[model samples]
Target: MAREKRTEQLFVTVPSFFRCPISMDVMKSPVSLCTGVTYDRSSIEKWLALGHNTCPATMQTLPSTNTTPNLTLRRLIHLWISQADITPAISKQEAADVINGEFDSNSLTKMIGFINSSEENLKFVALSNHAVPKLVEAFAKSDSMRVLELIVEVLDLISMENAVREKLNELILKSDGITDYLSSFNLVLQKGNTESKVKSARILELMAVNSDSQRKIAEKAGLLHELYSLCSVETETSAVEAGLSALLAISTSRSVKKELIRFGMVKTVGKILSGYDYSSAVRAVIEKSLKMLEMVATCTEGRGAISEDRECVVEIVKRLMKCSRAATEHGITVLWSVCCLARDGTAQENVAKVNGFTRVLLVMQSDCSSNTRLMCGELVKVLREKNMKSNLAPYETKTTHITPY
Candidate 1:
C-alpha cells in the first residue's frame, strides 16, 4: 500500500530529517502534524494548529485522521533528547554568566526573526537556559530596544515550573545585569513611538508576575519618562492597564513615586478617567489608579509626598467631578484617601489645594453612586468630627459612563 511505503520512507529518511527546522534538535517524540510533517514534540503541536498539512521540506500532505501511535512520541522524544548533552558544561548556577557576553540589539533582533522562522534556534535557547547570561549581557549593554523585547519574549515563553518559583527568585537575585537590561530597555521606550508603548506594556505584564521584577526595574538606573508615557496612552486599554500596574509596583520605592508624580502620573490617570475609547476598560483602569494612589498616599506627607505644584490633587478633583458611574466609584475612594492625606500636618494647606471639604460636599450633593455617597459622608464624618448633623444630606443617583463618539 502507498501508506506503507510512505511510512517506510519516513523511517528511512528520518536520520536526515529528524531535526526540527524551528528548534534544530533531533525531532524526538516525533508527532506528525496534519500537514503531513513530523516535528519535534513541543513544536508539532503548533504546526497542527495552523492547518498545515504538509512538511515544509517534503511538501507531503499529512492525513487528517487516524495517525495515533500505540506509543506517544513523548517517550521517543524523551529517549532522543535524553541522549542529547542537555547537561550544561557549567552548573545551573552559572546560567547568568553563560549568556552571550556580546548580545547587542542587532543580535537580539536577528534572534527574534530566527525564533519566529526557525524553531531550531528557539530550542537551543530553551534548552540552554544557562545561555541567558549571554542574552542578559547583550541586552544589558545594548541600546536597541528591540533586543530587550526579543529577550523578554524568549524568557517568558520558556517553560518555568511553578515549584521552581522560589529557586528562580533566588537565582535572579544572584544574577547580575538585570538593572542594566531594564535601564537600556527604558531608554528605548523614550525614543520609541506608539509601538514602543505596546512593547513596554507587555514587558511589564510579564515581569509583573516575576517576584523581583519591580525591584529590578526600579534599580535599573533610568528615568521613568517612558513608563509614564505608556500610562498616559488613551487609545490602548491593554497598554494603559499594564502601565498603571507597573507604576503601582514601582511606587513601592519612595524615590520612584517621587519621579512618577513628577512625570505626571496623576494627570495621565485623570485623562484615562475623564473619557476614553472603552468604558469597561476605562473603569477598570480607574480602579487600579484608585488603588495605586491609595498606596502612594499612604507613605508620604501631604506636601512632601505630592508633586510640589499640587497638580496631583487638582487633577484628581477634576477627574472625580467628570467621572461616570463606574469611574466615580473609584474616584470617591481616591478622594477619600486624599481627604485623609489632607488631614495630617498642613491640613489647611492640603484642604486649600483642592478645597477638599467642598469637593466632598459636591460629590454628596450631585454624585449618584451609592458607594460614592457613603464614602463622602464618611469623609465628612471623619473630617468634620460631626455628631448627627443634618447638613450631610446625601444624593442618590447612578453615574453615567463616558459616551463614545
Candidate 2:
C-alpha cells in the first residue's frame, strides 16, 4: 500500500520524452542540441562544460554545442503538470521550514513551485506561518543573486494579502530590521533584472503607506534614484508605472520631493509626456505623472523646475481637459502653482503660447470641481494679462464666469 501511494504521488506515468535523457528527471528547461536531441538545459550544459563535444544521449558528433530552448515541449510539460491531479511536492510546513531554515536552492525552488501552484491558499499559509518575515530574513542574509531573486519573487506573490503587506511595512519601518531589508531591496533595485526591479519597487510602494515610512524609505541610499531610473517611457508600462507609483508614494515628503527634483524627475516626466501618445494604458501613467508634478510644484524648487522646462510647462497645459477629470485637476494644480502661486512670468507666457486659455476655459465649462473652476478663472486672467503685455491676440474671456484670485 505504501509503495503504491508513493508511485501515485511520483507522477510515474510521465512521458519518457518529458524526462531529460541524462538526468532521467522531467525537464525543467528543455533545450535541443545540434544533434536534434532534447535534454534539460542545466544537465546538458553541465555535460558540455566538461569539454565533451558529443551529444550525451546519442553520442553524435556536435557541429556546435549551441542549444535552442524547446518551448513547445516546456509548454506541454507545464500543461500536463497543471492538469495532473498530483499532490503538491512541497507541503506548507516544508515551505515554511525552507524559508525559515538555512538557504537551500533546491528546496527554495520547491517552495516557489508550491506557492505558484496555488497562491491563494499559500497566502493564508504564509500569513499563519509568519512566512513574510521569514522571507525578509532570508532576503537579507542571502548572498547568491539567484537566491535573492527567488526570495523576492515569493515575497511579491504573498504581498498581495493585506496582512502580509502590513507586516512588510512594519518590517521596513521597524528600526531593528530596517537596515537589512532596505539595503537588500536597494541591492535588488540596483543589481536585479527588470522584473526584479519592478517587484522591488512595488514592494517599496506597498511599504510606503504613510509619511513616516515614506520618509524612512526615501532615506535609503540610491533607492529613490533607482526608482526614478525605472520611469522611462522606453521601458515596459508596468515598470514605468511601478517606478512612478513608488515615487508618488514617497513624494509627500518635502525632502523626498527635493531628492526627486535633484534626480531630474521633472524633466524626465516632461520628456515622457511629450513622447507618449494617448492610449488607455498610457493615460494612467500620464495621470500619475501630472499628480506627482502637482505635488512637487508645491515646493519652490519643484515649481521652479517645472516652470524652467518649456516643454514640461507646455505639456502641462496640453493635458488640461484631455484626460480624466483627476488628470485635468492635477494639470491645473501644477499650472496654478507655477503661474499664479510662483508668479512665473515665463510659465504664464507658455500657457498663452499653447492656447492654454482655450483649454482652461474648456475645463471650466465641464463639470469641474468648484475649486478647479476658480483656478481656471485665475489662469485665464493671468494668461490674458500676459498675452496683453506680449501683444498676443487676447481670448474672449466673457463667455465664462471669471473671478480672479
Candidate 3:
C-alpha cells in the first residue's frame, strides 16, 4: 500500500526580540518603550488600556504612556511577514500616521490624544519631556490669544496634582512673558469678560501654589485688589470661587496674610459670606471665606480690620451660630483673634455692641467639636476680661462682665 505524502508547510518561529512580551507573538508594529523594551503597538496599547503602567516583560515602571515607534524594527517585521507569506492584519500607513506627530496639532488635541490613548495618559503627558518646556516656550514665543487660552486649558488639567504644580511653578518663573502674564492678569481680573477673568483667577491660583510665587503675586501691583474685587462683587459664582481660591492659597504665607488683612481681605470675605445665598455651592464658599478670614485674623492687622467692620463682626457671630462645624470653628478662631488682638478693647466692645457674646455662648453650649468649644469658651472669657478692664473707663464706672445667656 502506497501512503500519500502529507502536504504541509514548514512553520517558522518568530525571533524572541521580534515578539511582543505582552502578547507573546511577533510584533506587527513595534514601538520602543521608555524601559528600553519593544512591544507591538496594539498589544502595548491594549496593556495601557488595561491601566498597566509598567512593562509586562520586566515589570519595570514606565515613565509615560507615550512610546516611540521602532520604525526600523517595524520595517524588518514587514519584510519578515512578506518573506514568510503571512497576511498583514493592520495597515502600515495607518500605524505610521498614528506613530508620527501628525495628530498633535494643538494642546487640546495633544491632551485629548494622550487621554484617548490610555487612562494613564494624563499622568504621562504631565511628566513628559515636552510638557513643562512646551508651556514655557508657548508662553515666551506666542502672543496669540487663542494659544494662551489653550495653555490655560493645559494648566487646568495639570494643576490637579501638587507635583505638577511645583514643576509648573519652576518652569513658568523662567518665562518673562509668563511673569508679565501673571501681573497683567490683574487687568483681566479688573476688566476682562467674566470667563477671561475666571481663567485669569485660576492661573493666579496655580502660580500661588508656592511661597515664592505667592510673594510675587502679593507684590504684584493691584493684583490682590483685583482679586478682592472679584470676590466682593462678581455676580458670577465661578469668578467669586476662583478669586476666593487664590486668596485662600496666598493667605497661607504670613507676609501675604498680613498684606491681605491690610487690604481688608478679611472684611471683604466676611461680607461675601454674610450675603451669600444658601446653597450647596455657597456652603463651600462659606467655608473657604471663613477659613481665609481666620487665617488673616491670626495677625494683628487682620483683627484690627475685622473689629473695624461692624458688619464683619456681626457676620462672624452669626456664622458661629448658624453654619457647619468647620465654619463655626473658623468663626470662633476669628473671634478669638479679634478678642485677643483688638487694640484697647475694640474687638470686645464690637462684640458687646452686636450681641456676639450671646452667639458665642450659644455655639459653646451646642454639640460641637472640643476644639470649637474650647475656642468659644476662651473668646467669652477674653471678652469678659476686657469688659472688666473697660469698666474702669472714665465714662462708665460700672464693673460688670458680658453675661452669656
Q: For residues 175-247, what per-residue lDDT tens digits would candidate 1 score against the true structure? A: 6645555665576566654444555544444454543566666666553566666777446655566577666
Top of the candidates by lDDT: 2
Which lDDT tens digits does candidate 3 get at residues 178-224? 55656446544665555556666776787785677777777777888
Candidate 2 residue pairs in backbone clash: none
lDDT of each: 0.51, 0.77, 0.64
Which candidate do you rate higher for lDDT, 1 or 2?
Answer: 2
Off by over 4 Å in 2: 1-89, 93-97, 232-234, 394-405
Question: Could you tally the backbone clashes for each prediction?
Answer: 17, 0, 0
For model 2, the run of ten residues with the poorest summed lDDT? 396-405
Candidate 2 local lDDT, residue 381: 89
Runs off by more than 4 Å, candidate 1: 1-128, 143-146, 156-173, 201-213, 233-235, 275-278, 301-330, 344-377, 380-405
